[model samples]
Target: MKRYLPLAALLVSACATEPAQDLYAIETAPIPAAVETAPMVGKGDKADDPAVWVNLANPAASLVLGTNKDAGLYVYNLAGEELQFLDVGRVNNVDLRGDLAVASNDETNSVSWFTIDSTTNTVSHIGDTPTNKDEPYGICAGLVGNTYYAMPTYKDGVAQVWAVATDAISDGPELLAEIQVGQYGQLQLEGCVFDEANGQVFVGEEEHGVWKLDLNDWTAAPVSVDTIDARNGLVADVEGMDIWAGENGEGYLVVSSQAADRFVVYDLKAPHAPRGVFTVVESLDGAIDAVTHTDGLDVNSAPLPGFPNGIVVVQDDGNPESGVDQNFKLVDWTLIQAALGLE
Candidate 1:
């Protein structure tokens, strides 16, 4: 069933003249608990993004790939144990498809890739693709039939869409499309996700807002789904976007509000339509701490052991327990959905 937000949501967003949620603010959702936590491999501040590779045969064995911006990439298990660590320079963001994973190698300003072995729960650094940009920030996968595509966002607000193959096609990726994102002079861009089911590409503009373009036609103009300035529910520096696919062409577009330490949820059908914003607060079960200053995150609908429906992996910039650099937290999707009253 197709789900659409109330008419009021569209009316308010059309003019962009009033606050989206004046006094009508969504309450914080209890995070329940952290299933697992993967800390950054390097000593400095790392653990920027996470990409989960589901082990279809056994959901409990799924592998989570995350980036350590200070050093390299890390491979972890569903239990959050570090399986492998491949030092391939600084990788900012990463995404997985089939047996391949692509990343933004900020150290060399190129696209780094890996071959995933679900059985071993490890990823081998295969090759690198130059992004042709000074610094590549975020990266995600796009698919056309059996073919794979890599979409990388640069620090200059230029996002390059490419058709990439994992089997020794080339040392780099083949550019298929390119679009310069972000608004005003906000060149810094990050947090992007490809709606493989839908025909859209959603990306975050740090100091500006969230924008989406047609996945089939990148040359087309983009539509601003949401924006942030001084007075609004969304705080400055909009970051990290993830899709929670639901039944019947329905889901949510979750965005990380860095400055406010809250997460905003939007209807998947009408992404521009506001749903409700929620923060990860302390759980009554007293299992995990609240999440603050999240950078990159990912979610899956597949059911697992602890999370029957699925789970969300979010990079926690603050590690209060160890007082370390950063780490990624695994949250139960069922609790989030129940709290938000999302079907």
Candidate 2:
């Protein structure tokens, strides 16, 4: 009986450690029946990604910079008015560094530089990064001290993090470190971000899960921290990622599951072992593609009135022929908070 007692206790503990079933079940409130539709800047061009720049003087009036895949970057006002477009055709990812917006062209194997005039909401093409590899998908900028770190999706199955100075753009991004992630058949690397506060960078592989690497020690290889399986109606092709900090400067990691038409949220307070995966349902009417394969996300602090904190913006790859409506959607975090019982 004593031996049986020990075995029973072990089984109970194992079951207790398992993630709660309801963690992945998201209770979503219907987005207002009338979904606001933004105008498409160009035809046959999918609106890929977006970043927000707050107008400090007038928080009510902010700017959103969106990537028009294969066309260029488009700037829009808070009311979704198209301000301007700079044609530097890029197919992959786009990001901002101060007043400069950087775009990666996977097919061309290049990154383009542009200076954005915030006041006028215009972008000027400065130059392009010396080309490399076949497809450079994921690109993000992180400030380490005074230098800016640029990460580009590398071909041949690895991603390179570069240390770029003002002049380093012409010579191509300098190799700071390389992270080799497991490949799925022939699928390549996709979404990535550097969390400064955590002193680590998160990289997402198309067919695999997300990985975490410590920048303090570049030589240290990345380890798989989370595995996103295609279960519970969650999209298997994970693409974009963005970090949201809580009131105390600690928060969650939000990732997109392109095929399943959902976004998964993971609590990052535990670092190694993340908890709670919440799904956000895509608007059936606004889905740009047959599947709400959402790509690219940017969270703004204090975006709308009353909601002083902020909101998240996501891109829809409108494939109307297949029942997808190409457009961007503003996700009210306040609504998310209420769903998570935070409210």
Candidate 3:
């Protein structure tokens, strides 16, 4: 079920120039995926991000939602079977909470909403509402009490907090506030997650690192929790991130170090200390290939199928085995915890 290869074997060729000590990634053995989604429409970097929806009544029936940036959103079963496809073009990133699913609709320059029918285990297109930003880049949504809040980022490092009404999915969300995450027009900010428990949102500045904004105070400046430092094992282009929730507000924040083909973990709580780093490699049977050049990822701590402690779904830009298009891969969070010796 797992394969242990030499750390040197996994070192990417791009890192040949940098001194080995500069890379603080734990270099744990690669973990294989439990399942993988069907390839995207047509080849060449189509799949971008994924969202996991747990079926409380039947955890085995939980679903995975992903975005095919060129085509639309895909609904897949735990087994990686394509259940449904919503043809909303150029959806960059997606996140779901409660019954509402929100994605960054790049084609329309707005945020497209969808409804998750738990009764039927299906997702349907709700509608989209315009955004003030010219390029509606990445997004994440979560419930802060009874209200659903969505944080959508733009290429220019500007992000907005919106309150989406479940009763009116088509009408879009109410813009609560807009904050400049970094120097305007100088930052490429995307892939954000709402830490509702902390009343803050963590945004990734692709080339720089991760920054946090306290939702309670929109006027305050963004805080740098981590930077593109070798000590933290962050290469350029930190793509996607999601929190691995634990009981009593204890958990870890997982981030994608895209250019390096690895993911870094940090304490979900502030000070946000770096925990470990890992990457998905080929399965023992060579069915599913290693994931590289990842764009976005999502994590859930709720138990599901082989992922007893929950699952992590990541965008695999190169589906080497299928030799078709990009797709998402599902890995058990327990495997990651065990690999990194996390509590």
- Model 2, 1-343: lDDT tens per residue? 0001245555665688573332233433332111223656456547777776666656666667777676777777666667777777765677765665677776567777777665765678887775556677777767666567777775455877777765555555576666676455444666777777777877777676777778688778777657655342234577778776665547677777676555666665555444334334444565422224578876654646534557767776654432244666566676655655542
Instruction: Supply the global lDDT for candidate 1.
Output: 0.77
Task: Report the C-alpha lDDT of model 1 over 125-209, residue by residue, as the tens digit.
Answer: 8788887777888988876676688888976788899885555345466788779886555667898888877778898888887
CA deviation > 4 Å runs, candidate 2: 1-37, 41-45, 154-156, 166-173, 183-187, 230-234, 247-249, 272-291, 302-307, 319-325
- Residue pairs clashing, model 1: none
* Model 1: residue 244 alpha-carbon error in angstroms: 0.8
RMSD values, in order shown: 6.6, 8.6, 4.0
How far off is residue 113 in model 2, in Å?
Answer: 1.7
| Candidate 2: residue pairs that collide | 258-293, 287-325, 288-318, 288-319, 288-324, 288-325, 289-324, 302-309, 318-326
Taking the tens digit of each residue's C-alpha lDDT, what string does model 3 give over 177-236?
A: 988896523588888998888777899988788999887788889999898864577767
The best candidate in terms of TM-score: 3
Backbone clash tally for model 2? 9
lDDT of 3 at 32: 85
Candidates 2 and 3 compared by lDDT, better number: 3
Query: What TM-score fits each model?
Result: 0.87, 0.78, 0.90
